[model samples]
Target: MAELRTLARPYAKAAFKAAQEHEQLAEWSQVLTIAGQVTANKSIRQLLANPGLEEQKKAELILEVAEDGVTEQVRNFFAVLAENRRLTLLPEISALFNTYRADLERTVDIEVTAAFELTDEQQQKLAQALSTKLERKVSLAASMDKSLIGGAIIRTGDLVIDASVRGKLTKLADALGS
Candidate 1:
């Protein structure tokens, strides 16, 4: 998985640069997201892995599946990937591209799981607090997980705050065991 990320980084950076130069970061993001989903399909993966299939055809297949989001620039990007036999790296490239986009946009996507649903006011307060804490615009998404028992777990990027009762109990158990 790390090797795949290493191999995909250059392509992701190149795509990001192209998107920035073209002033179409959102469009490129959409195209990459669509292409990634298309490539992630099991049948599509098999098709991409077929040695007999020509590179251009592989690119075309992805483009056809994601036609709604494809632009000429993105089409050319796909062609480059296909030529280099890096089409299978679309998922990693898309992820890295989004990471780059989020950084440039000064935004973070936050996921919160709690024992119960959060009210609109609660969510707004949490988002405001997180925005101030992370110093980035927060896009908060909330979900219910009864297994949490109480409190909530907050996740954004590589950071996680496990404040749930279940998490606390697990930590207590580990401490006692130690």
Candidate 2:
């Protein structure tokens, strides 16, 4: 998986640079996402893996599947990937490109799982707090998990804040066992 990421990074960076230069980050993001999903399909994966299929044909199929989102820039990008047999790396490329876009936009997506639905005021307060804490614009996606009992768990990238009652009780039990 790491090797795949390593291989995909340059392509992702190149795509990001082109998108930034053209001021088409949003459009390119959509294009890449659509292309990634197309490449991830089981039948598409098998087609891409077929050694007998020409690279140009593989690129064409991908472009066809993502026709609505494809632009000349995206077509060129796909051609390059197909030439290098890196079409299978589309998913990783899209993920890396999203990471780059988020950094550029100074935004982060956070997931909040709570015992109950959050009120609008609470959600706004949490978003403000997270924006201040992370020093980035925060986009909160809130969901409820009754099993949490109370409190919430906040997740952003690799950071996790487990404030749920279940989590606290588990920690207490471990401490007592120790």
Tens-place lDDT per residue, model 2, 1-178, is 9999999999999999999999999988988898889888999899999999999899998888766757789889999999999999999999999999999999999999999999999999999999998999999999999999999999988899999999999999999999
For candidate 1, write residues 29-135 as lDDT tens digits: 98899889989889989999999999999999888867675778888899999999999999999999999999999999999998999999999999999999999
Query: Top TM-score: which candidate number?
Result: 1
| Candidate 1 lDDT score relative to the true structure | 0.94
- Superposition error at 133 for model 1 (Å): 0.4
TM-score of 1: 0.97
The lowest-lDDT stretch of 10 consecutive residues in candidate 1 is 62-71
User: Which parts of model 1 are misplaced by more than 4 Å?
Assistant: none
Candidate 2 residue 46 Cα shift, in angstroms, is 1.6
Cα RMSDs of all predictions?
1.0, 1.4
